[model samples]
Target: MIPRYTTPEMGEVWADTTRFGRWLEIELLATEAHAALGVVPDADAVACRERAPQTDAAFVAAVSERERITDHDVAAFVDVVQAAIGAPAGSWIHYGLTSSDVVDTALCLAMRDAGRLLVSAADTLIATVTDLATTHRDTVMIGRTHGIHAEPTTFGAKAALWALQLDRDRTRLRTATETVAVCKLSGAVGTYSNVEPAVEHHVAEALGLTAVPATQVIARDRHAELLYACASTAATCELIAVELRHLQRTEVGEVLEGFKPGQKGSSAMPHKRNPISAETISGLARVVRSNLLAALQDVALWHERDISHSSVERIIVPDSTTLVHYCLQRLNRLLGGLVVNVDRMRDNLWSSRGLVFSQPVLLALVAAGRSRDDAYRIVQRNALRSWEEGVDFRQLLENDADVTLTPQQLDEAFDLARSVRNIDRVFSELHSMASR
Candidate 1:
């Protein structure tokens, strides 16, 4: 992943240093596991662990040089670690384990840590949206159907929908993390020819992963699931980004991302405060989504396994995780610092001269014994007249002979509060999901 899209913490996790360090740790642990089976002496396992950190820059350079000849990355890594410890202790470094054993398990560890950060970011966004929903529970706005005002609704209802979606995002990430947290030490063909299933079980327990039943690698489907979850979460963030972009439009001006002091929206335009962060999240979401398609393509490989998936995983896994983390973090900040224009929302609510309240008025007339079609026509005609002639829908309905509703009934129909009478129930539902 590029620095522009990657956060430092996530970027560091996938750094060569961190990756090699984990590889070294896995090698040492495998040696320890083998020692327990009397495959190596306890002294050698301890010595390997003690000297494991010494596989530093010079050692990696030497081993990478060896890979130029051996043409195997894991084989070179093992040779390097063995050279660091020397003689008998070095001999037990990668005993009874394959490259995927170390590589897949260590990848799980990185993903576990990344999942924690992503969930935290999602929770932060959910909290901000929840707070916004509660604060604007009665703040009315015109709800649109086909880019035109269709009905009345509170801004809180819109925010509550976002909150509910984020709750689902958290659930999806949890499932993805669990699915990918699997370990395999079954060796080449997964028949446990050299290493026993018990060794795999123990190694999985040691690394806080579940033992996979059988694997050429730890099942590419698991990786696919994880990438899809990450991309899907980013897609949801894009939904919010789109909404924020729409609301921040000059014509709308109903909501805006917080404009920081000293921040510039344009190079030369003096009066500009754009929703750049929201737009940023939206833009980066495309990268995450594109990476997920690559992960899906990785699912089908040559029987047992193939290295084709390996190279792609090297790019998609770290890039997708890091990109999603950056997006979630930025979206959290955007939601938390959102500047909602309640007065503008209220003003826009009446922009169509109470035409947004047409549906309720139509329904009320139908309940008063008018045919549904007749009620709809009456409401539609009055609404179109109000929009074009700047007359109030309610006043027109009151004067139209075709309309049968009483003044009291018209008053009830025009009530936006009545339209959102279930707001509290919706909020309660959002809170319940948030608690989970």
Candidate 2:
């Protein structure tokens, strides 16, 4: 993740200093657990905390050089911390824990922080979409199917749908956070050969996590669950991007990305105001979804564990979190500054020659003693003629004797107000959910 796309707060979470600091926290927790059991001196535990604040940049820089030969990140980190803490106290640093005791647990702490940031971003996005929907609750627009006007629906309804989907994404994300918030201090093959189960439990409690029931390296499935949730959330983001692209199309200019003053859309075309934000989000979604394959592949590691999953996770976890955060923040800002063309939406609603109100007319005729088949035929006939001949569907319905309804009844059938009568109910539902 580059500095440009990554926000300062989230960027810090993935920095080496921060990751090293989290690793030390996990190590200290383990030390505290050992000290409580009389495995390490209480004074040594205090010294451990004071000595190892973080793996300093100068020390990490030098230790990374050692990692080239060692071919192990956790080993290199341990060696660096040992030098900082001096011999005796440093010897008790990772007494009864394997590399994963520190690696996986510390990774959880970092992920927990990252998840909190993503949740905040998601909440902001949902609020922005909901606010926009409320403002445009009655802003009529042509609801299209296969790129052609099929019926009338409010722009608010479409935004509300996005908001609702985002809400589900939020829930999925929260579950992912909980699923991964577990730690394991089991030795090499998860046998408790060197470390006791009580030590693992105590360490987990000290680090604000739960101990895994039985596992090797904290169970890769939890990691997979989080990635799956991230990919699914990215899919929802892509759905919004697709919609924005369609609305910004030249022929259907019902909405647009905000065109800030002096913001150039293109060097060649001065008149162009592209939906770049939406397009960028759409492209980033592919990256997130593609990473999911790696996550699933991570699930089938060799026996207890393997390095196969390790390499993939180093990329996916941080990248996915950063990408999702980037997308949510960008999307929220885009929606907040969205340029809605209410008049254009109303104009496009009628561009299809009143055919949008066809369903209401068809159902009205069915209710007025006409067979469903007969009513469908009457409405479809008039709709097709209006579409082909550029005539009003309502006028054709009024003239057709098959449509036994009076002029007033026909007028009521074509009313846009009637089409969106349930909008209030929908908005109320969203408002209630958002408040919670």
Candidate 3:
């Protein structure tokens, strides 16, 4: 992943030093397990454990240089660690174990850590959206269908919808993390021909992972699911960003991405204030979504194992996780400082001159003994006249003799408060789902 989108904490999780440290820990744990089974000397296991403290930056550097000569990463790592531990302990370091046993298990540790960071980012974003919904629970706005005014709605209801989706994203991220939190130390072909099953279990327990069936490596389905979760969450963030971008349009202007002091929206246009943050998020989301296809493609490999998935995974896993974390954090900040124009929302709601209240007026006519077809004609006639002539719809309806609604019924039909009466119910349902 590029430095521009990588958070420091997530970057560290996939760092070379961290990967090497995990690799060495798995090696030592397997050695100790062998000692417990009386397959290796206890003193050699102790020496291996003592040597772990020395496996730091210098150790990682040596492994890198060795890889240049050996042309194989895991082999180079084992060679360097074995030389560091020396003699009797060095002989037992990689005994009865294959390279995938250490490499695949260590990769799980890295992915598990990265998954936690993504989950935490999702939590922060959910909180920000929930607060927005709660704060604007009564802020009314126009609801549009096909870019035409349809009814009166609250901005709070829009935000509550987003919060509910974000809650689902959080659940998916947690589940994906759990799905990949597994270790597979089974030897080549996954039959444990040389390495015992107990060694795999011991390493898995020490690393707080579950030992699962495998063929040279843990199944790619688990990793595919993790990427899918990231992609799904990114798509959700994009959904929010696209809406904010539309709201920030000059014609709409119901909301704006918070612009910091001295921030320039455009170099050539001085009066411009753009939704750049939301646009950036929308762009990054595409990358995360595309990575999911690569993960899905990795699910099929030749026979028991092949290196085809390895190269692709080396790119997708870290990059997908980093991009997701960055996008979620950016979205949280964008919403936290979002400037909602409540007064403008009100102006926009009534911009159509009472046309949004046509539904209630139509229903009132039906209740007053007018046929459904007759009521539709009466409402549509006045609505079209009001739409084209810039006259208030209610006034037009009043002048129309075909409209049988009484004065009290007309007032009730155009009531903005009545249109949003069920907003509280939606919020109650949202809160209930959140608590669960």
Give Cα-based local distance difference scores for all models. 0.85, 0.85, 0.90
Clash totals in order:
0, 0, 0
| C-alpha RMSD (angstroms) for model 1 | 1.6
lDDT of 2: 0.85
Candidate 3: segments with Cα more than 4 A from true spot:
53-57
Compose the digit string of candidate 3's lDDT tens values, residues 314-337: 999999999999999999999999
Model 1: pairs clashing at backbone N, Cα or C within 3 Å = none
- Measured with C-alpha atoms, the lDDT of residue 134 in candidate 1 is 86
Clashes of 3: 0
What TM-score goes with each of the models? 0.96, 0.96, 0.96
Q: By lDDT, highest first, what's the ranking?
A: 3, 2, 1
TM-score of 2: 0.96
Task: Indicate the worst ten consecutive residues by lDDT in candidate 2.
Answer: 53-62
lDDT, residue 89, model 2: 90
> What lDDT does candidate 3 reach at residue 354?
94
